[model samples]
Target: GRALGEDYEVRAAATAEEGLAAVEADPEAVDLVLLDIRMPGRDGFWLLDRLREGFPNLPVVMVTAYGDTETAIEAMKRGAYDYLVKPFDVAHVRALIEAARKQRALTRSAVSLEPDAPSPGDRIIGNSPAMVEVYKRIGQIAATTLPCLITGETGTGKELVARALVQYGPRAEKPFLVVDCAAIPKDLLESELFGYEEGAFTGARKGGKLGKFELAHGGTLFLDEIAEIPLALQSKLLRVLQDGTFQRVGGTEEIRADVRVIAATCADLEARVAAGAFRADLFYRINVGRIHLPPLRERRGDIPALVRYFVQKHGAAVGRPVTGVSEDLLRALQARPWPGNVRELENEIRRLLASTRGEVLAAEIPPACPGEDAACGELRSLAARALEEGGEGAFHRFVARAEASLIAEALERTGGNVSAAARLLGITRLTLRKKAEEYGIRVPDPDA
Candidate 1:
């Protein structure tokens, strides 16, 4: 109390009832609460439910004893701002408080889909016909608890679509959790989704932990890169989807959670299932409602609006607000084949915002290599010629010639500057130099 009292007002309550009384007497008296999980009379969770129901905006941080981290995690799932294990230092508490305050403010704001709204909310900005279909699909399903599968190439804003689904849904006020299947290690993925019991495994936290399904009760859980989940764990996921019941990693008691599952992936699940890499049953279960987002290249008409939206969004964040982008820049942007989709385009715009000095952005957009169709056609022609002339090693010879040609072209365009050339080619300077040397392509001095 002494440590925090020096920095904060520091209200004190001995028991859960007292804490409730403290808040009930005057809710405005407290901005945050530090509640312990093992309190007398009414437990922290019971009180937490009251706080969340009575004052949904109030941020609460769970204070748990050492070895009770899992319970703390469960409290977090129940809308606690954060948790702190006993024996934490003063610095940790302060840092958590600051973070929680910032996040609380951020979460309360609504997300907007308005194309040209002045507010800092329109995270999704597009009016293309394809995108209109996406919006329509979201509107149709967002109000239900149907399990949804979002499919799109990477950076096509799958997560944003998932967020839109949540924001427009009946569970808008509930917790929304995200798990990136590709990002987490395969061995750890199961535990992350379902959590584990204390002593479930060596080095596991003391108290049994609640998984996403349990934590996200009455909310939404988004699984990104859904195809990456291991084949072994697919059944457990399917069980939850079918019955809304799953057990913790080391515990046997079945836990049921009212969580809506929304999954996203860039990979083809049908192909994965055919290859025995994914479960067909699970695939069908989650694919009940599907939304496919088109790649940025396919939605070229939306490029100008996206560009303007990104400029405004990033400019304000970086304190380099621009008046507008030039028509020539928009034309150039629309012409490029953004292999990385919306994310890549936003990055290009951010780069321009950083480099441009004028209020109106008129910087020359770098020329793109080629549209997908044209590039594929060019490759087909090259391969046919190679097959006819190069005979036995046609594939290898064609690849070598293509690499050498691209490297030589990039070097020439960049005036033999290896780093600049490498950036243009989307490769490391060292790799470019090695390839250039192997191909006997002339490059100026490394420094020059």
Candidate 2:
């Protein structure tokens, strides 16, 4: 049970003392520690505090018999990566381990958050000149407290650039908050950015609420989709930027704001300004330290690295282990035009990892059919076949023949490994077996 299926190097400690000793002997030996709360001598909470102070970046998973909402919240605040109740399954523990490892890996990566990185974009994965320029720009911006504007196509990772500025900059030690101007309702956005006094508006919380600007007083506020901010609210935003001061929604006292703003937009703010939708002055102010991210298609060399990262990241977390990815799969990934950019690629890998039952293959990836839905490729082929050989029930014969051929091919290639074949055909193993029986298909045994 402790082996975590052989992929992880599990270290056992009968007691908290032994665990602490193991950690102390080689402080960096453990990537994740699963400490039980009911251990003899000092409890897990005490050990948690010690480990947190000693290795601040270490991911810890706390297991406890006394699970509750308050306990869970407290454990999280104490820097526990995740918590498992007494009766939790081993699968849950494995998932938590994956999450922890991914978290730790992201923390150590130099590109976005690594302070004192040796070279420009040292942590970023790509060596493309465009990416290299972005890295250099990020380093330059990180040296000062200038308001930065990051512009890119949707899903090009604008937030990542914003994060790099904060993590490698003077504001590294302070809180960094984000507000999506497009996601939140415009009517409530002002109050959300700036606090509102009690009874100032209906549905307002008791006492008052501290806004993102006030909460991020000594840190950074990342405003995503800056172009979406309503024209009426832009004046207030301008005033805040102008003198670093703003009042509550219904109050007269001006709150002296002292927060740095990093704005991002996928839209052309200059076009918006010219169209009289966005404030020109605010656009220019935030545009001081600018960084534009290239779409994934323009950075094709980075695709392989990103795919590996996502596969490892999601496979571990979701418990769908893939031994390796086929070269054919890599080629399929590289050839596509990712309209959704890096975010799309990450989601695709994650979805593939979650669905695959064994080694990932080229057949598992969605085919790149131009001007047609990948899901309907088979249907399109069948339709064309029906047109080629027209007769009564020709469509029915085509569907049945195609289905039988697909099932036969999948079983043949997998050596009758039902689960693997099922994954390849994107169906359940039981469904495949039933279909084989219905079609009287002869599936060969592995040792035949």
Candidate 3:
């Protein structure tokens, strides 16, 4: 306090408890905290936890004798603005304090604007070009009221994207309702959607309940597995789309709803329409603004980012220190064809974190699918061929080389166990064995 002039006010406490008490007594007065790591009663890290829980916006700079990378990373994870080693320059400390203060102020301002605007949530985390484009499209679509149809394979985060759209959209202030069309019983779907008037059905409520459509007024209504919506109900839904009016069962009064419709489906609606099972008109209506989320295998570049995000998220949820994802583990993740997509990746990360005992992630990561290795070999062969040929002929060479490489790799991975390889490749075992013969790929014998 004596060293610094009136421009700064310094408070001294004998113990961590006293310091915490001083801050508790007057939180606003304390702009920055210079915490000593070896404080009595409670260490700086413990104090950091208290600050994080009570006042997350407050910045705490840890003071240590020697620099420790693990400790610094952990402290940063625990909300410490920065750390300062002992014998450090006074100017460095001043700079750190200023930077921390600026960061805190910025965080507070950002939090105040839209606390629930999906600010880098653990569900969708990536900064890759593909992911950036996805985010840009989401933001652009959020401004409009166009109906969106999200088509993706199971576990590709279709619903998460839908929620992002709703949360960031203009109608974010209103209710965002979700209806799992596939989960609801087909017989009761109409009542669930259009509501039944009093005495309209034997078990109808006395006051007549509000249907999901009316409940989602001035907001977004998300229909999951839209292809499951019964054919008969599809016509009623289409009417609601054409004109924002739906009539309650046994009631002549028409109810109008102002809501943005967003639908998701794993099934091919075109196929169902062709089969006369789904209404073509309804399909066309909901498919106005389509967003097809790429499967995880197609976006292998995002695996590392996703792994990091999940490790941090799950580690924090379980009160464990954030762990590092090893290069080998990342390579395994990249090689695997994530048929289940982001949801599958999240589950795998959670499992790894639960079984892991320390800070390294690779040790606990489970064995990867053998198919991944084969796929990687095929990709490498394709790259090699592409490099050998010039750019003009690279595309043709790569395609042929990839096909041959895949057939050879598949046969080799199965140990000439063509039947097993066939199943893995999603083809008949006989077809796989025949292809292996045609490609002249020497399949290894099981005995060898």
Rank the models by lDDT, top first.
1, 2, 3
The candidate that achieves the highest TM-score relative to the unseen native structure = 1
| lDDT for each residue of candidate 3 in 1-448, tens digit (9 for 90 to 100) | 4544345688987678888899999987877888888877878888888977777657788888858898889887786766788877876666555555544443343233221233255345554445544554564466568899998766677888888777666787888998987556677888888888899888889998888998998888999878767666788999998899999877899899988999998666775564344688998999888877777777788788677767766676656674487898889888766655677788788888777777778754555546565346336434543553344666655564455446655655565576777787899866765655543344445456
lDDT of 2 by residue, 1-448 (tens): 4558477887788888888899999876688898898887888888899998877667788988888998899898887767899888877677566656544544446223221223333234554546655665675577568788999876678888888788777898999998987556678999999989998999888998889999999899999978768778898998887889999998889898788999998666775564345678988788888999987878897777666666655556566455567787888899887766777787788777766667663346776666754335435434543453454667665576467557766766676677898999999877887876654454444456
Model 1 lDDT, residue 448, Cα: 55
Residue 384 lDDT in candidate 2: 47
User: TM-score rank, highest first?
Assistant: 1, 2, 3
- Whole-model lDDT per candidate: 0.77, 0.74, 0.71
User: 187 in model 1: Cα distance from truth in Å?
Assistant: 0.5
Q: Write model 1 residue lDDT over 1-448, tens digit each, in one string.
A: 8998888888889899899899999875576788888877888999999988877666788887855657866886787766778878998788666545433332333223233457545566676557655665675577678999999876788999899889777899999999987556678999999999999999899887778888899999999978767767889999999998999998899889899999998767775564344688999999999999998888898887787778767777557558788998888888887767787788788888888988888899877654566456446444543564533777776696578657766766676677898999999998997986665454566555
**Which of candidates 2 and 3 reaches a greater lDDT?**
2
TM-score of each: 0.58, 0.56, 0.56
Please estimate how well model 3 matches the true structure, expressed as its whole-model Cα lDDT.
Answer: 0.71
The list of candidate 3 runs beyond 4 A from truth reads 1-123, 368-448
TM-score of 3: 0.56
Question: Once model 1 is optimally superposed onto the true structure by TM-score, how far is the C-alpha of residue 322 displaced, in angstroms?
Answer: 0.8
